[model samples]
Structure formats: structure tokens, C-alpha cells
Target: MSDLNKLGLAEARDALRAGDVTSVELTESCLKAIDEADALNAFVHKTPEIALERAKAADDRIKGGDAPSMCGLPIGVKDLFCTKGVPSQAASKILEGFKPEYESTVSQQLVDAGAVMLGKLNMDEFAMGSSNETSAYGNAVSPWRRGNDDAQLTPGGSSGGSASAVSADLCLAATGTDTGGSIRQPAAFVGITGIKPTYGRCSRWGIVAFASSLDQAGPMTKNVRDAAIMLETMCGHDPKDSTSAELAVPNFEAMLTGDIRGKKIGIPKEYRMDGMPSEIEKLWADGAAMLKDAGAEMVDISLPHTKYALPAYYVIAPAEASSNLARYDGVRYGRRAQLAQGDGITEMYEKTRAEGFGHEVQRRVMIGTYVLSAGFYDAYYNRARKVRNLIKKDFEDVFAKGIDAILTPATPSASFGLGEMTEADPVQMYLNDVFTVTVNLAGLPGISVPAGLDSQGLPLGLQLIGRPWDEGDLLNTAYALENAAGFVAKPGKWW
Candidate 1:
């Protein structure tokens, strides 16, 4: 029990039930790890008191033989999810002091399942950046680094905090919300397992909205089994969120037979972009080979609209974000800008926003507003919507051809140093989501599994996009690929 913080969710659950470890011991171990790893800035708000309280309750339930799969387990909650009385800022200054009066459906579900909350993990402001650099609380540094390099790297954002914490063993698992590549990319960078379930699989109620249609909450864990276990408790139908699917939640962990025999896995030909790094290409090829070796048939597939996905996603996501964020005027909760004498309401609105939002958030809001403007709505927003449907149709066509899952590299490259791309054109930063935006556009379940390391010794992951509502089959295939890859290398502790 010395390294109890290192235990995955499954391992911790088993240990708690076997009486080899108490929930208090496990929670305290994680708390100690969090205290020591403050340099990572993974958890912006540490709730050791609440965690201990929950741990004591979980221990009693386990002693009475009433433990659920996640009972007595300690995990991190993303700042995006509103835990009652806990600071849920979404890493934006606008909502700096705002605390939700109620818990998010997803986080509440985890609590109901007996999971202890360690704290709110850091993330990009309003969950809007590819790297965690946009966070008002400051960047969540990745624990991984190049050989002997001291330059801090990003734990890909906006779920970077969740990724960094889980990767560094600060927590067994953490919740992450993926708008484009937020969850998967960071999970890849940190060498953890993350899945963005098919849109509507998890409720969005009480979570800060970025792009209403694209945002989906998921789990980032140490391994596939831990992800599977955490995902089971995180997803379910909720009346509070009209977008939440009415389908029954399945026991995803129980479906990890890992027998993907005869499963047709597709390799999209269009993912091979120009100037693609040799390592990423080789990693994709290696992932396909692993799937093939797992008794699955591999076929070359065409997502002809793949190239258009990135552009369409940018247009559509920002447009929705503009609409969703319109409610944050000075009249509502959160910070209000100090006004000069005789300042009118309009000035208050403008000043409050100007002072509240960060650079990236302002840029996205402007872009979104422009796209939805009367003169350009049809040209940009409407066109993007049409293109989005076409992209979704592309996936449908591939899945219709008997493709059980589509395999590709999770990220274009490994984790880059902080401020590396941000100072350049923002498009360079946006390009990080090139390999991930399609899954959100199609509303499909996609997972990133740590497949291998780049030449710099940083983790790289392979993505598997599954048919909608078939996360069980998807997890099984990821399980198979994970087994084949055998990627067990962890970051050498420097923080």
C-alpha cells in the first residue's frame, strides 16, 4: 500500500474490497501525491476534507458488503464539472468566484456510485484551447518531457489538468470533457487512456458549455480497464439534459472480453496528411498492424470529407460557443467589470467581457459572432452545418461497410513545449486537433490508447473511432490494441 496512489481504479477497487487497503489510506495517498506534485498545477482546488469524508463513507459501505464498482475510489473532477460548493471555473477568469449550487449529473453519478472527489482539475478557459496555456489559473504542465530537457510541455488541453494528474499518479482517474481533441489529445500526451463517448452518452447539465453540440465528458485513466470502469459510472440518460440519450447505460467494464476476431477495422486513407511526421505515420501503421494481428481484418477506407472536417468543426464549434456564451453578460453570476462614471449598460457589457475573457476565448467569440452574423451566416455557419452532416455521413458510410472501428494516430505529434505554438499563428495551435475533430462532428465514440512513445520518449496514442452507441465493441477493440501495444512506460517523476 506504499504506492497506493499508483493503483489504477480497478486495482484500487479490488484492494478496497479485499480489505488489503482502506479508502482512507488510498485517498490520503493520493492527497499526499497531489501536495507533492503542485508544480504540475493539475488540481487547482484540492478538497482533501471532502475526499476524506467520502472515503470514510465508502469504507463503511464496503464493510457492509454494499460497494459498487467505483466505491471507495479517489478520482479527479475536471473544473468544467460543477461540484456543489466547489469552485468550478472552467479555468476562465469570468467565472472566477462563481460556484454552482448543484452538482453536475456526471459528477453526481460518480458520487452516487461512491467515488471520492479529490478536487477540480485545471483546464483551458471555457475548455477552448488545444494546449492548456489558455488557462487563467496558468498552464497544467505535462509530467512527460524530452531527455534531460527542463522546458515544461503541455498535457494537451483543455483537459490537460486531468491528463497530467492521472499520468503523474496524483489520482487514479479523472474526468475530462472533449470538445474537439481536448480529452483524447491530452490523454495521449500523458500516456493515459481517454474516451469521448458518442455525443449524448453523457449529460452536459451543470458543466460549463463550450460548444453545446460538440462537448462530451469522459474519463481519463491509467489504463483501458480503468477507463472502462470509470466510463460506466460517468454515462447515463438524464432528463436534465435534453441532449442526453435515452438509451440504457451498459456495463462497459464487463464487456472487455478483448476478442475482436473478425472485427473489420478501417484505416482512413485521408488521415495521411502532407508533411506528416515519419513517427506518426509509422505509429498509425503499427496500430493497424496490431489490430490485424489481433485477428481483426484491416481494410483501407475513405472518409472523403475528412479534410473538410477540421474547417467545418472550427466554424460550427465557435458558432455554437458564441450562442452558448451569450448568457454571461454582466447581469448574471460571476465577475462584473468595474465601470467608470456615467458608464451605460452597453459599456458595462463590453467592459465586463473584455476584462473577464482571455485572449483565446475572445478570439473564438469574435470568430463565432462573425460566422453567425446576418451577412455571413449562410456562407459560413450554414455551410459548416451542411459540411458537418456530410462528415457524419462519411463515418456512417464507412461503418455501413462493416467496419467495426476506424484506427488512426490520436495526435499529429507528441506533446510540444509550452508557448511553442501559441506565440505563432493560432492556426498552428488549431492544427493539433486535426486528427480528432471528426469524432465530435460525427457524434461517435472514440478512444485514445497509449500505443508507444515518440523518438523524444514522449507518449503517442492511437485513436479508434467506433460506431455510434457501440462503446462496448469500441472498448473491446481498444482493449485488444492496448494488449498488443503493451505500452506501460510512465513518466519519470520530476515534479
Candidate 2:
């Protein structure tokens, strides 16, 4: 038999149902893989005891014929999700040793569906940076590398550990949260499938907040079908989160019939940025051609505000982040700093925050604070909100014109070295989110499907943005693209 850790979520589900394997066996396989792949830094926390306990219970439930699709599947939870008694640090020093008393709504729902928790995965500090370099624990390295270069690469940011774990086969599938391009970008970098549901599709109640308006929880998996299965388990209505959509969750896997005939896919002409690599342009064109052959009609469209998405997103996200991150003071949970002899409350606050936050988190908080400051609010924050509305309107106009989903390159390039952009201007790192932020800004569902490999043998992905509250349709289109693209490449195991 093949290694159990190599099984995808869907495959594991089918195997469990057929009595060919038990949840405990799968959980053990993943735990062993997690141990062997420690150098990858995918999992920052390991819950072997809890995982086995849950797996045993899952075996009972499956044998009793009361199993859900996710029953007996082992999954890695992103640190952003508050798992009860497990450290939910959001990859920041300020949140170090903080464990929530209550479970995150999304994670609890997955547990209720019989999914076993492998552990908490690493991520960018407070989900702030575009590359995984901002993580306080250290960067989660991508499994892929340039041909014989042996230099480590990044697995993308915020959800980097989630992407790394899934791509490295450290876990069957993992949870990821997207604010800006966290989920999709990392997934693209690691050659996997990841989807960000419509903004309110997944509840945000227990997940650590990073830009309250843009943060959303979704799954990072090895393939499109596994993404469908995991996403179905992660979404639902929660009264605790005012932003949670009140729609009924559908069987997303059932929607993946791979029939996109007569569906209209829009190609925004504005995405063809100057100096784009020929490989990316060729990959995008090839993806469109595949969809066309699969019977999806290609229509040229434009999102006029595309050029402004990155700037507007930077302003709006930081502004919201400043507001949401204010709760982390010395008085509350998590880490606190030792006071100097003459330090006052003001000094304590300054000292605690300075010591607790990573450099990137501090930068974002400063930028956020500046934008929302009294004199600059109108010039930066408010203006950015207006631009955000225009960006949303652009997408609305495209969808109104009968575009089922918009197709674009998931990232400008494939995975790069971990410290490649860290030395340059921060704006260079921010540009990594250009293709994905608009989806978050517009509160639309978007997915990244691995389409092909770049010249260096690194993976490249294509993105599909769908109408609000229309993830089912978006997923179906991604399924068709996945089938037509037929990208099954995996990184050679060097970790």
C-alpha cells in the first residue's frame, strides 16, 4: 500500500468508507510525516494526543454508518483559527501562549464533521505579510526549489504553512485564512488548490482578526475536488459573527460535475501588466484555451480599477487592522513585558507592543494608524474606501454583463527565494497581492488552480473570481479548469 500520508482528502474519505483504512492509521501517517518534515516548519504545534483521540472516535462513527464526508480525515488547522487549549498565536509574539477557551466556529464545525486535527500550522504574523518571512516563529519553507539550486523558496504568505503542509504531504489538507491573497497566493506557490469563499461565507468569530472586512477562512488542499470537500465543511452561518452569511451550506462536492459548457469566463485585459514574464502570459492563455476546449466561452472584459487594487487594498486593510488589533494590550491575554523602574502605563503599552510584534506587523500597524489618524483619514483612509467601492463596482459590472467567472493568473510569478523581496522596498512585496486583493475587496469568491509549471520547474496557478455568494458555481468552473489543465506535478522530496 502507498503511504497513507500521500492520500488526498477525497481518497482518504473513500478509503475509510470502504473499510480499507481507519482514521487512526491515517492520522498516524500524517503525524509521522509531520515529524519527518520538521525542517519544512509547516506545523508549529503538534497535537498527537488529540489527533489520535479524535481519530479513534471517527473510526467508531464510520463503523456505525453515521460518518459525514469529512469523517476520519486528518487536517492541519491554521494558527489563526482558535483551537481550544491549543496555542492560537496567529504567528505573533504578542499572542504567544494564548489559547482560546472556546473553539473557532469554523474549526469546531470541522471537528463536529469528524475531521481530526493534526496541529496548528505556521503563518505570517497576524496574516500581514505577502511572503511567509514575517512569521515570528520563522519562515515556512516551500518544498519546491529551482533546478538543482538547493536554495530554499517560500510557500507564500499568511497561509504559507497551510500551503507548505498540504504541498509537502505533511497533512491530508489544511485550513487557511485569506486576507488579501493569503490562501490563494500560498497555494499557487506550492502547487496546490486553495479557495477563498465569499467574504462572509465562513464565520470570522473565533479566527484572529486581520482586517475584519477581508479575512476569511478556507481550505488549502492538493486538488480541486479535495478543495470542494474541505470548503463544504468550513462554511456556514454563525450568529456570533455579524458578517456571516445566513445562506444554507450546499454539498459543494456534488456541484463539481465538471460540466462548464455554455458558461462564460471573462478575461480582464487589464491584468496583462507590462513586463509580465512570457511564461505567466503563456500559462494564462493556455488555461483559457483549456477552458475553451472544455466548452467555456471566453469573453474579453475589463476591470478598470484593477490598477488601483493594490494601493487601495493596502490602505483599507491596514486601516481596519489598526482598529481590530487594538485589543492586544499588556492587561489582557498572551505575553506581557517586564516594566522598567520608572515605566508608566503608556511605557508599558509601548514596550509590550514593541517586544511582542514582529517587524512587519509593526510596520502594518504603523501604516494603519497613520492612515486612520485625524488629519490623514480623509486623504488616505477615506479615499481608499472610495477606490475600494469602485473596484467592487468594476467586478459587479463585469458579472452583470453575464460573466460567470473571471479568469486570471493566480500570481505574477512562481515561488521565489524566502528573502528575495525582503531587502527591497515593501511595495515590491505588496505587489505580490495585486491579482488577489480585488477579490477580497469586492467580497467575491476566488480560487487558485495549479495550471502548469514555470521554466524553473516551480508551479504556476490560474485564478477564478466568482460572483458574491456563488462559490458553488465558481468551484464548478475551477473543477472544469483543473480537469482540462491536468496538472499533477509534485515537488521532489528533498526536505
Candidate 3:
């Protein structure tokens, strides 16, 4: 029971059920770890009082023999989730000091299941950037450093803090919302497991909106089993969220039989982009080989529209974001500008937003507004939507051929040093999502599992995109990959 903070979800659950350790002990261990690791900047808000109170209650529930699988486990909630009385700023300056009176359905579900919330973790401002650099509070540094290098690296974003915290064992797991590659890309960078279920699988009620149509909340955990256990607790129908799916939640962990025999896995040709790093190419091939050796069949497939995914995503996501972010005009609950005398409402709106939003958020909002404008709506917005449909259809066509899952590199490359790409063209950062945006555009289930390390000893991940509502099968395949890869390397903890 020692190093309780390092235990994964399933291990913690089993130990709690067996009466080997108290919830307070586990919670305290994580709190201590979080207190000592401030250099990581993973936690934006620490709620020790609330965490211990919940931990005590969870221990009582376990003692009463009425405990859930997640009962007494310590975890982190992304700042995007509206935890009542806790600041849910979404790492944006516009929402500074704004605490919701009600809780997000997904976080509340975790509470109902007896999970302890360590605090709100950091992320990119309004989930706008690929690197965690856009956060108003500053970036969440990765626990993993390049070989013999002293420079800090990004944990990926906008779920950077969740990925960092989970990878560093600050908490057992954390909640992450993915609009494009927010969850999976970060998970890959940090050498952890992250899954974005089919859109609407987790209710969006009370979670801060990025792209309403594309955003889905999911678990970022240390391993695939923990991802499965936490994801089950986070998903269900919510009357408050109109898009919430009404399907029954499956026991995802139970499907980890690791028997992928006869499962047809797709290796999409379009994923082989020009100038892709040899390390990443080798990693992808190795992953496919791993799955094939695990009794699964790998077949070559084509998703011709894959090339359009990033462009379509940029247009569609920004359009939705422009609409979604219009509410934070300084006249509402968040931060407002101090206007000079005679400054009217329009000036106030202009000044407040100019001062509040970070560079990335402002850029995207402008792009979104432009795409949605009357003159260019057809050329940009409508066309992007059409391309999105084609992209989704491409997946449907492949799945119709009986491909159970599609495997690809989770990211184009491994984690880069902080501030390394700040001076580069913004498109360089967008390329980080090259292998990931297709899943979001298609609204399919995708999971990223750590497969191997590059020459610099940084981690790389393999992605599995599954049929809609088939997360169980996807997770099972990832489990097979996990077992095959045997990726047990933890970051050398300098933090």
C-alpha cells in the first residue's frame, strides 16, 4: 500500500475494497505529491479541504460496504468543468474568479461515484491552442524531459494539466474535454492513456463550450484499465444536455479480455503524410505489427478525405467557438473592463474582450467570425461543413468494410520543448493534430496508448479509432496493444 499516490485506478479500487488502505491515506499522499510538484504547474487550484472531506466520506462509504468502483480514489478535474464553488475558468483570463453555483454533470457523476477531487487543473485558454502555452496562468510543464536535456517540455493541450498531473501521479486520473486533439495528443505527449468517446457519449452540460458539436469529455489516466474504469463513471444520459446519448453505459473494463482475435484493424494510407518523421513511421508500423501479433488482422484501407480534416476542423471549430464565446462580453459574470467616462456599451464590449482573451483565443474568434460572415459564409463555413460530411463518410465507408478499428500515430512527433515553436508559423502547431482531427470530424471513438519512445527517450503513442458507440471494442484493442508494447517507463521525476 506504500506509494499509494502512484497506484492506478483499478489497483486503488481493489486495494480499497480489500481494506488494505484508507481513502484518507491515498488522498493525503496525492496532496503531498501535488504540494511538492509546483514546478509542473499542473494544478491551478488545490482544494485540500474539499478533497479531505470527500476522502473521509469515501472511507465511510467503504466501511459501510456500499462503495462504487471509484469510491475513495483521488483524481483531478480540468478547469473547464463547473465544480460548484470552485473556480471554473477554463484557463482563460475572461473567466477569472468565476465560480459556478452548480456542478458539471460529468464531475458530479464522479462525486456520486465517490471519487476525490484534488483540484482544478490548468489548460490552454478556452481550449484554443495545441501547446499549453496559451494559458493565462502559464503552461503546464511536462514531467518528461528529453534525454540529458535540462529544458522544460509541453505536456500538450488544451488538456495539458490533466495529462501532466496524471502522468506525474499528481492524481490517479483527470477529466479532459477534446474538441479536436485536446485529449489524445496530450495523452500521447505525456506517455499516458486518453480516450475521446463518440461525441455526445458524455454530456456537455456545465462543461465550458469550445466547439459544441466537436467537444467530448473523457478520462486521462495512467493506463488503459484506469481510462476504462473512470470513463464508465463519467458517461450517462443527462436531461440537461440535449445532445447526451441515451444508450446504456457499458462496463468497459470488463471488455479488456485482451482477446482481439479476428478483429479487423485498419491501417489508413492517408495517414502516411509527406515528410513524416522516420521515428513516428517506425512507431506506427510497430504498433500495427503488435496488434497483428496479438491475433488481430491488419488490412490496408483508404480514407481519402483525411487530408481535408485539419482545414475543415480549423474552420468549423472556430465558427462554433465564435458563437460559443460571444457570451463572455464583460457584461456578464466574468471579468469586465474598467471603462473611462462616456464609454458606451460597444466600447466596453470591445475593450473588455481585448484585455481579457489571450492571443490564440482572439485569433480563432476572428477567424470564426470571418468564416461565419454573410459574404464568405458559403465559401468558408458551408464548404467546411460539406468537407466534414465527406470526412465522416470516409470513416463510415471503411467501417462498413468490417474494420473494427483504425490505427495511426497519435501525434506527428513527440513532445517539443516549451516556447520552441512560439516564433514559428501557427500552422506548425496545427500540424500536431494531423493524425487526430479526423476522429473529431467523424465523431468517432478514439483512444491513444503509449507504444514506445523515440531516440531522445521521449514517449510516442498509437491511436485507435473505433466505430461509433463501440468504445468497449476500441479499449479492448488498446489493451492488447498495451500488453504487447509493455510500455512501463515512467518519467524521471525532476519535479
Best by lDDT: 3
Question: Please, what are the lDDT tens digits per residue for candidate 1 over residues 1-495?
Answer: 599999999989998999999999999999999999989999999999999999999999999999999999999999999999999888988897988899999999999999999999999999999889999899999999898999999999999999999999999999999999899999999999999999999999999999999999999999999989999999999999999999998999999998999999999999999999999999999999988898999999999999999899989999999899888887879989999999999999999899989999999999999999999999999999999999999999888889999999999999999988855599999999999999999999999999999888999999999999999999999999999999999999998
Alpha-carbon shift of residue 264 in model 2 (angstroms): 0.6
- Which portions of model 3 miss their true places by more than 4 Å? none
Q: In candidate 3, what residue range of length 10 has the lowest lDDT sum?
A: 422-431
Q: Model 2 TM-score?
A: 0.99
User: How displaced is residue 303 in candidate 3, in Å?
Assistant: 0.2
Clashes of each: 0, 0, 0
lDDT of 2: 0.93
Q: For each candidate, give its TM-score against the true structure.
A: 0.99, 0.99, 0.99
- The alpha-carbon deviation from the true structure for residue 445 of candidate 2, after best TM-score superposition, in angstroms, is 0.2
The model with the greater lDDT, 2 or 3, is 3
In model 3, residue pairs whose N, Cα or C atoms come closer than 3 Å (at least 3 residues apart or on different chains), thus clashing, are none
What's model 2's lDDT at 130?
A: 77
Tens digit of lDDT per residue, candidate 2, span 210-319? Answer: 99989999999999889999999899999999999999999899999999999999999999999899999999999999999999999999899999999999999988
Error of 2 at 77 (Å): 0.5
- Scored by lDDT, model 3 comes in at 0.95
